[model samples]
Target: MRTATVSIGVSNRHVHLSPKHLEMLFGKDYSLAEVKDLGQPGQFAAQETVSLVGPKGIVEGVRVLGPIRKSTQVEISRTDSFRLGIKAPVKESGDLAGTPGCMLVGPAGTVSLSEGVIIAVRHIHMSPKEAKQLGYKDCDRVSVLVEGERELCFHSVIVRVHPDFRLEMHIDTDEANASMLATGDQVKILGRTQDALDLVG
Candidate 1:
């Protein structure tokens, strides 16, 4: 099966902080310094990194992404979750309800979170125009076919459409390794949800 092709971007473990958490971890009046622009519009990787302390272990040098959000969230891979001994559910960004939490240690200070860690679900970010062209809508489920040395099909990929979004599929490190996919690689959209069948057909 073949359909539209989307560029792939491998996402590493990272944290997004709210202003208050940023202040508590970095320092009062501290602001994130952009290291580089990301594929998604307006989102960038900060020069700063922090250590995540979980019940079982600590993972260091986790990049911080900017700009700051309304709430702090940690996105890790399932392998990292096992290493840290946290059962982080696979969730979409900003869906932190009932998620796990961990302590974040920065240069100036350390902050403990009550809850907000997750194994980010695989998703595609695209603009409305691109979504319409591909016969996809926001929150629609789809599958993707990755071809090459490590061929595989990724299911339950969420479609996220926004005016500011660029057309790209985001997968965590583990998924990337399993499929031997890296940033700038392309994946073919195989199928979408049943309701959108006719549209893709």
Candidate 2:
């Protein structure tokens, strides 16, 4: 069986703003300032931060990821959703059709989104060559073996393949904490469903 080791990327709550929303939140024609580069190519953590206002409470200083997207999306953990009183569905990124929305407060203005909040599913980002080498394709779902004090297998991890993607598995803070995983930690890719079952057996 084809196997490979991938690095972990622990994702915290972040927001991806559309150009229009970016302008509204920051100012007209404003651009995001790159504070740090992320694992993925051409993605960075912006210097700006915003507060999310929900029915129950407010979460402040949520980092903004760059560059801008076609639509604004808010990615939070299930625990954060509970704290904010929003019933956000677990979905892949960019699948924000009927998810919950919240009030976003920025230094210049506020945006009341009608919909665009989700708890992002776990995924792995890899280049096409890497995916081929590991016998994986884009959109394929597989299980991963993480070793530590909280050793466990992560199932249904979606594979994302692109020319520019770096080899890294992205998991939310909740998942990371549950598995006692940190960024740069290594995990074993156990191929498809049956392969994972075989390993467990």
Best by lDDT: 2
- Tell me how far the alpha carbon of residue 42 in candidate 2 is from the true structure, in angstroms, after superposition: 0.1
Off by over 4 Å in 2: 198-201
Error of 2 at 172 (Å): 0.3
The Cα local distance difference test for each model comes to 0.91, 0.94
In model 2, what is the error at residue 101, expressed in angstroms? 0.7
TM-score of each: 0.94, 0.97
What is the Å distance of residue 116 in model 2 from its true position? 0.9
Give the poorly placed runs of model 1, Cα more than 4 Å off.
193-201
Q: Would you list the clashing residue pairs of candidate 1?
A: none
Residue lDDT tens for model 1, 117-172: 99999999989988888788899899888999989888789999999998999999
Model 2: residue 31 alpha-carbon error in angstroms: 0.7
